[model samples]
Target chain A: MYAFTYHRPDTVRQAAGLLARKDDAKIIAGGHTLLPTMKQRLASPGALVDLGGVPELKGIERKGRGLIIGAMMTHAEVAESAAVQEAIPGLAALAANIGDPHVRHRGTIGGSIANNDPAADYPAACIAMGAIIVTNKRKIPAEDFFQGMFGTALEEGEIVTKVAFGIPSRSAYAKFRNPASRYALVGVYVAKRGGEVRVAVTGAGASGVFRWTAAEEALKKRFAPKSLEGVKADPSGLNSDIHADAEYRAHLINVMARRAVEAALGK
Target chain B: MAAVSMTVNGKAVTADVEPRTLLVQFIRENLKLTGTHVGCDTSQCGACVVHVDGKAMKSCTLLAVQCNGASIVTIEGLAGADGTLHPMQAAFREHHGLQCGFCTPGMIMSAVDIVNRKGSDLDEHTIREELEGNICRCTGYHNIVRAVETGAKAMAGSAPVRQAAE
Candidate 1:
């Protein structure tokens, strides 16, 4: 790893100030993805602003009709939080099922969303639930936040403060994970609120993460596994790798969507 | 380098380490805690797993300077003062959970934390799902899962751990 200045600010404002001043500074929240990249020389930031000491960036709470999770709240905390499980059991289950116990305990929601790895699970949950990402600068809707693979709309030095997920009537995340990394080979998150249904697909599509409009529309009419039949994922825009081919991923999109629907329905 | 101080295995220690020095590196190198193996430099492998502030974490992926003033527990500290094996360690041995054992320290550490937080009632599916980040090249997961089960039972004080399942 290259040499860099490390600063552990006690407050978010101080961290933000350090980030704004350094031309190439990276915020370290959990450091699951970023640190590895740095070690591989994929990223060579001039400074590292550690967010672990920031008190304001680590918590989980229910704020009115939504769940507000601090950016630094670890996956383990999210998976085990009584409030999260009670309010969004699917979210908790997804958290509990991510990477592994050690990764869950170290990786944070902020780091996962910010890194936006195509196979990561939190993006699907955020997009499906119509969550709002609260950053130091502005609030970004989940729909507009993700730009592409390993990309988000976040500007430099803009530390995510919290993510606010709207409490859904019911929601579920289903994925066929890669055996090695446990990242989704093809994952789906289906959320229902009122009469609307949102389907977010990760790890399958070529665009990395996209909404399955056909599946969503079908499920909105009647939320059921059968409803997703014949609604094929566009294989042209799907990812293909050694773990799974495009055709297989397309099939998994349908299969996982069905399972997600079933899970959401408590079947 | 930065001057940092923290408690490791219930003892206070201070060291000057590079800003990029990972906590696991500091523990294994400076403190000579080689039991905390470094598997993948990436966070995907939990081989560098350790308890930070009483929570399991991928220490390889975290900067040592970030852990200033925090409490840490590594595999070296899992044993009792009298050198008795931790319940998870005993269970692993009883269940033949380790083959080559490269992943044993991490697997055992992760399992211990999982049962501590999730409880002894954890089903096989949950344990399988939770072990996703921990890779065992020997593929001894069949026994690892059984070990976690037996260890959890022991933790709950239900009974002496049973033999490996099937």
Candidate 2:
């Protein structure tokens, strides 16, 4: 790890201010991702503004028609939260399946969504559920928040405050994880809100996380595994890596989407 | 170097460390608590799993300075006060859960928190899924899972009765 100054501010405004003042400053949530990247010399920030101590960014609550998850809330918290489980069991189950117990305990949802790793599980849930990514400056729709691999629409000094997801009637996440890293090779989240169905795919895109529009259209009509049978997910822009090739990933997209629908339908 | 203080294994201690020093490094180098091992540079391996504020966490992913004033528990502190091994430690011994023991501490620590929080009614599938964070190159995870089930029963205070034989 490179030498850097560490600031532990108690409030979000103070932390954001510090981040704005320091050049090359990065916000540290659980440090599960950032620390490893720093250790590998992938990220060399001049300063680290620690958000672990920020009280404002750590909470989970049910508000109005949705659930509001604080940015600093760990995956374990989300997985174990009664509110999340009751409101959206699929989201809770998705959180429970991420990495492992230790990673779930320390890896924050904000960190996972912010990193926007194409293989991350949270982005798929966020996009499919149409959650709102609330930052210190504004609320970015999950669809617009994720730009590409390891990318997001977050601006400098803007910290993610919370994520809000409206309660869906039915939803589920299915992923074929890379056994080594437990990251999704092709993960899909299918959610049905009233008459409309939304499908989001992660880990299978060349440009990183993207929605499977064809599957979504079919699901919106039928919302069943058979509905996605003929829906051929275009592999034109899917990621091809050592773990899996583009063709295999496209196959996984179909399989995972179908399974997600099955899981959502309780089949 | 930065001045830091935290509660470790029920004792409050202070240390001066570099800003970039990882909690695992501080525990191993500064305090000489070498029970926590670093298996992988990335956070993928749970060999350095420890309990921070009563929850299992990968210490390699956290900064030493970040843990200042927080309560931390390591494998060294898991045993009973009279030097008796923890239930999980004893269960592992009985079940031969460890092959190399490199991953035992993290596996046990993570398992301890799992049963403590998730309760003893946990089935083998739940334990297996929860143990995904901790890796064991040897043993094929058969004994480790058995150890947790045995340990969970022991922790729940309703251990199976062993019948005396002639």
Candidate 3:
């Protein structure tokens, strides 16, 4: 890694100020992605504004009809939070299965969604559960928050403070993980609130995670595994790699969507 | 250079290191505690696992500066003051859980965390699934599973623990 000035700010406002002044500063939480990239010399930031010391961005609480999770809450905390399990078991399950125990202990939900890795699990949950991302400036809905892979609507110097998730009526996630890295080869999240159903597919989109409207429409009409009998995600813009071809991912999305529905229905 | 200070292996240490200095490097080079091995620097292999503030995390993935005020318990800290083996270490020795032993320290660190979270009453599947982060090419991981099971039980019964400075 290149030599860089390190700043450990205790508040989001202070961290934002540090970022605005530094020409090439990177906000690091958990350091799972940023540190690795720096070690590889892929990202050479002139300054690293470490957000690990910020206390305000490290909690899980209940607010109104939703659960507010501070941005620095690690994946392990999310996986083990009783409040999260009660509010959204699928999100808990998704958090539990990301990477591994060591990775979970260090990786944060904020960093995961901020990186917007195509194979990350949190983005699928965020999009499916209709989560609202609260930043230092304003709140952005999940759909608008994710622009593409490694892309977000967050402006420069805007720090994510928390994510608010409305308690869903029912939801579940199913993942086909790559055995070596444990990243999702193909993962699907299904969420139903009132009469609406939303399906989000991760690890397979070329541009990034996306909502499977076709599958959602089918499951909305009839909330059952068989309802998605012939539903298929478009393969034109899907990711195809050595792990799985675009056609295979399209097929796995259907299979995973079916399993997610079944899992959500307790079958 | 920046001054980084942390409690490692029950000792408060302060060192001046580059911002890019990894925690594993601080432990191995600065502190001269070679028990914590660095197998794969990419954080895939758990050879650099250690307890940071009571949770097992990859040391290679974190900078030493990030752990300035944290309490770190490495493999060397698990032994008794009289040099008695930790129950987990004894279990591995008794169960022959290692071949080349490249990943033992990290495996033990992770196994301790597993037991710390799930407690002593662990089933075989849970043990196997929880070892996802620590990989062992030798012994085919069968013996490691058995060792962790027995070690967890032993830990429940009577395992010597050093007082950690919170």
Q: Per-residue lDDT tens digits of candidate 3, residues B109-165?
A: 999999999999889999999999997867459999999999999889653343331
Give the alpha-carbon lDDT of every model.
0.88, 0.89, 0.92
Give per-residue CA lDDT, model 2, range B1-166, as digits (tens).
Answer: 8888999999899988989999999889988999998988577678999999999988988899999889999999987666677778888999999899999889889989999788977799999888888888884599999999998888776343221110
lDDT per residue for candidate 1 within A1-267, as digits (tens), equals 788999889999999999989868888888878888888998999898989888899889998889999999988889989999999999998998887777777789999999899998999999999999999999999989998898899997788999999999999999998876678999999999999899999998776688989998999889899998889888887887889999999999999999998998999
DockQ of each: 0.72, 0.79, 0.83
Per-residue lDDT value at B120 in model 1: 79
TM-score per candidate, chains pooled:
0.93, 0.95, 0.97
| Model 3: residue A241 alpha-carbon error in angstroms | 1.2
Q: Judged by lDDT, which candidate is best? A: 3
Q: Tens-digit lDDT track for model 2 on A1-267?
A: 899988999999999899989999999998888888899899999999998888888889998889999999999899989999999999999998888788888889998988898889999999989999999999999989999988899998989999999899999999998877778999999999998788899989987778788888888788789988877888788877799988899999999999998998889
Which consecutive 10 residues in model 2 chain B have the weakest lDDT in total?
B157-166
Please provide, for model 3 over A1-267, each residue's C-alpha lDDT reduced to its tens digit, 9 standing for 90 to 100: 889999999899999999999989999999999988988999999999998999999999987779999999999999999999988888898899988899999999999888898899999999998999999999999999999989999999999899999878899999999877789989999999999999999999998899999998898899999999877778899988888899999999999999999999989
Q: Give the DockQ of candidate 1.
A: 0.72
TM-score-better candidate, 1 vs 3: 3
- Which pairs clash in model 3? none
DockQ versus reference, model 2: 0.79
Error of 1 at A119 (Å): 1.6
Fraction of native contacts under 8 Å reproduced by each candidate: 0.95, 0.90, 0.81
Look at candidate 2 and give me any clashing residue pairs.
A206-A239
